[model samples]
Target chain A: MAMSRAVLEGRAEDTDGRLLLLDPSDNVLVVRARIPAGETIRVGGGVPVPVPADLPLGHKIARRPIAAGEKIVKYGAPIGTATVAIDLGAHVHVHNVKSDYTPTYHLLGGEAGR
Target chain B: MTMRGWLRSDGRKGIRNTVVVGYLVECAHHVAREIALPFREEGVHVIGFPGCYPNAYAERMMERLCTHPNVGAVLLVSLGCESFDKRALERAVRATGRPVETIVIQGTGGTRKSIAAGRAFVAAQRAALDAAPTVPMDVSELVIGTVCGGSDGTSGISGNPAAGRAFDMLVEAGAACIFEETGELIGCEHIMAARAATPELGRELEASVAKAARYYATLGYGSFAAGNAEGGLSTIEEKSMGAYAKSGASPISGLIKPGDLPPRGGLYLLDVVPDGEVRWGFPNINDNAEIAELIACGSHAVLFVTGRGSVVGSAISPVVKICANPETYRRMEDDMDVDAGRIIEGRATLDEVGAEIRDLVIGLAAGGRTRSEELAHQEFVLTYKSFEPIGPACLPAA
Candidate 1:
């Protein structure tokens, strides 16, 4: 029910840049807009971070460096675990993180259809 | 606001008075479709079970669908040789005091002859349904269901949570609200169970998700689909959290399986995974199949949240589409009812979009059609499955 200051000011993009921090405890932030590789975007409190890959809208970005075998937190809960160590602002997705509950299926490079 | 509703014999009220034309098996699908073709624009819908073999789950689902409050009358089309018990289905429909007629392909001479008879029955029933009287209905008498498909990150933050807020509001107003896909709620079982009204119900809630985990594990596939991953979801637990938001923050009233109605006006979690074994390939093949199950649970309308975007509407109930991503909404504006993505963009708050959804449901009850209904998306799908009866802890009296 609490409104963010950026949202109240109608300047969410200015405050959080393209990455949205769902929970303060979350190590990953959701991409509000697509950020092509080699572009620099600000993170929490306008800390500049370089985009290593083309992060599409709705994709997740590492809020901080995550160690291998560590739980990847989002919405203040563990969504999955980092299969490999992930650096700050890197794209956090199927390739780097794997589900502890069930295998994540992808068309290009997963157990299904190949 | 009070709205006009079609009152059924069992005292349930419906926002629509549709004449459902159901084919008993895949063999009769064509004839049934041909019969309902001419009357498609006149509130006549086509629904069927494709399995030729008899399945108790399918039979119960068919009966519940035929007797759905939205259904005014039923015209059954049978292929004559399928193991499906057409007679028992007809008897169940008859017990509801609704006009029921059956046309068997073999008994009625041939395909052309059966279609003619079926059309004739539908024509008469449609006319009577047109003249059927509607009684005044309130929000308290309504039962609404929610499901999410093509989910992404925005779904958790925007569409799903907004829909969840609407569910909370509906539950507060004394209307029954159901949220399903325990298969998708894998990681959030403990969180969801804590909301249960009773401790026993909480255990049942956890057991349901555990069953889903086991079922999908056995099949070597989770509810997480390829499109889901493409839409930026990395794992089943992540998608489960997003889907779980559709349940809102209301106290979990009870747990019911497919075809089981919520006993009172509160929030209920639908345990959609089949019991005992993973016999039915997958719990739900697609979104429409889940929608059909929700309709069978007596949902007058279903709130469908999508991020990657889906264009399906159910045969028995109207689907209110809530688009989660702002980009997806721009690309598929005509197909969506609410742009829940506005919340993500800071154009609107969750409470604002939630109220919009609640108002839309009320408006639909007063005869306003959804974008899907306007586009003629009367999609329905049902497959084979099995279920055990709900225990006492599932629904304790208020």
Candidate 2:
């Protein structure tokens, strides 16, 4: 079998910043470590983009601009659809992306907008 | 290829020779626990159905568990008034050629009398089981199941995929591997459907996930728990992408319900969610509940991948904990068997971790105890649920 980590291993840093691209088709990068607001982060061999907000680890950040209601691709599959237009380096979370199978419920309050 | 194993008359082999003390109803749980308590040092475990009312699902699960390959004997504790088919269970155990005894609390006078009688029966059975003949077993004869719990952002990247690699190696060696929780596989149905061995099987795979999505939608909540978000997951579909990695790259051979066994050596998916309406609150109440379903389907061992760290093991089967987070593994190293998180930390590769997990499985089957087993983490929880019989298309070979 092909090396397992090679296909799915998340990246912490690659001389750019700690962002992981799970699949080549993915439009978002998983945060390997927490990033401070306004910090410039480079990912997927693309140009560096400045972070709009401080994001926790494991959360996602858009690698590039995405249109409103577009399917958000991660792991080479659609995890959810973008609720509104997402800009590069913007945090992609419940506020921006929502699950297509069922409503995504946030623990703090109500469900995300579908 | 041969390992020391208990050979049953029905032609099943067991890695561990265990005696299960089952309580037929809630009324008999106390006496059953008391009987198995002192023998905890031995391969004795307590299992029961809490409901006094008869349920077909419970009956089948209890029967399959009692006659599981790991069990060498069974002791049934009945309240004498419950509707459980104790006679049928006893008969089933007898057919498997294992020593079985029933102690009716009402007939035995009381709890004290029943406990005394049950203990003596256990002692006799234990002596017989020790003298039971053992035969050589092979890797191809084993059945393994995989499930991920307490998932974090690192799960999909590390532990789950490492487990998938191990699954691939096992399947290639002709072992029956099972991966479940269609509720968690929601958005990836289209991707998973393509991995089915046949076009019909692909349809069955997609339909199963679709059914789970609809059922969870009615419940007003996805299969995702709040802790999932705490660990970096944003939605059930995102968690699924990581969870789906546990299946590795094997072609799904079939789809099965709780008690259905795979016909041959290949990968299979256990449909944990029920067919019709949600009769019992949720498909799986907790992680161990899923482990129970895997056990009922005849899993000899379960590979549990956890990012946030779940320290649970099953009663009849051994659970090998694969930690996805390096930090979590550091805090709970004793509970874990393989450190897939090392891949995320750049200390090891996924193939290396997969090989480590594969070696661990072979070692456990050959009598090496896992950390969970050593710590006595025999967590078992089975709740009420309903399932219709599987169709011919479900298991084409069977």
Candidate 3:
């Protein structure tokens, strides 16, 4: 098994070169075959990012300039909206985005529907 | 490596001996509950749907479930005002050679009067069921279904895949295996369609997922649960990729609406989304309703996978819970069976965890009690909804 959290355990490889980007919606794609880190593979005819030695089977990789109000498309469906503008090739998730449900400060976390 | 079970004439084995007190519609739900409440210690479950609208799909589902091998006897309760075919359901139960009785609420007088009558009927049925001889059976006769609730990112890689392995093992052993909630299999339709046993069946598979997507899209809630986002899932499509893996690699044999049993079984998808307009908002309002659909499809037990962790068990069928995330498992250790998160943590491999789950499936099929069953956790819930009958391609080749 590979390392879980990319931030904590993933390391960029400096090996061979091959680049593949999934759909316009997906942030990442499978290696299809192995590629060494630091090797650059052009994606969407754009300049390639260093083959970050650490790519897992289903990990995410950024595609578009996701704006705050923009929808994060994957499998080409709207999952949720971005809370802040995210640069191209940047990781987009909770730290940069939030849910549609507003939080009520209840001293502690209030259970949903309470 | 196997265990023993009791075989029913219908070619199914029961892990637990039970009698289901079924209400044909909502009018009789309370009466049936009052009937079973007094026999709570006897493993009698009050299970029923409260739909007055006549649905052939729902009617057939109720019949198969009442005659399921797990049920020792059945008592039908009706409101007399509803459209549910009470006579057909009772006859179906009787044809299985299972003792059955029917009591109408209006016909029997009022609520208390009907409750009293129903209670007496259950007591008598309980006595008769005791006389049913235990027939020796094996794991090959078992059938299990699986579903995920409170899913997060971990569920796809962990519990879902592990349960898929178990389903594979059970099917290989000649035991029927089922997995449902077509609403969750949206984005994987093309891949899912290719796995159908036949091209026609593939089309049915595609339609089911399409219906689910359209239904949820209308509600503006893809099955991309909010908890999934917190657990690292970024998009509904990503979440769907994980959910799609639960069906294992079997060629889908049929597509059945709620309450429709697979004629035979290779792998079947239980389409829980409503057929027509979204009358209920979501076909299944909660997890237990999904579990109930599995029961309606004649599943003897359910494999419940959780990432955020759901501890609910069913009223009649047993739920073997598999936790996907190691951290969540650590927090809710008492509620789970196998931990698939071990693979990501380097404590186990997918193949290793898969084999372990297969082993547990056989063990449970052989009558080894699941934790939910042991805890006497019989959580039952039913609600009103309508579903249309399936298309021609829905069932497999004759």
Off by more than 4 A, model 3: A1-91, A94-114, B107-113
CA deviation > 4 Å runs, candidate 2:
A1-17, A33-40, A44-57, A108-114
Q: For candidate 2 chain B, which ten residues in a row score worst on lDDT?
A: B1-10
What is each candidate's DockQ, to 2 decimals? 0.51, 0.44, 0.11
- Docking quality of model 2: it rates as acceptable
What tens-digit string does per-residue lDDT give for candidate 3 at B158-213? 66776776677677777667878776776678888998888998988888888887
Under CAPRI classification, how is model 3 graded? incorrect
True contacts kept of each: 0.61, 0.52, 0.08
Q: Pick the candidate with the highest DockQ.
A: 1
Arrange candidates by lDDT, descending: 1, 2, 3
Query: Distance (Å) between predicted and true CA of B282, model 3?
Result: 1.5
Lowest lDDT 10-mer window, candidate 1 chain B? B1-10
**Model 1, docking class:** medium
Q: Write the per-residue lDDT of candidate 1 for residues B1-398, one digit (tens) a residue.
A: 65879999899998999999999999899999999999887899999999998899999999999999999999999889999999999999999999999898999999999988988899999988899889999988999999999897778878988999899899999999999999999999998999999999999999999999999999999998788888889999999888988988899999988899888899999988999967889999999999999999999999999999998888989999999999999999999999999987778988899999999998888978999999888999999999999988999576
Tens digit of per-residue lDDT, candidate 2, span B154-212 = 89988999999899999999989999999999888988989888888899899899889
On DockQ, the stronger of 1 and 3 is 1
Write the number of the candidate with greater lDDT, choosing between 1 and 2: 1
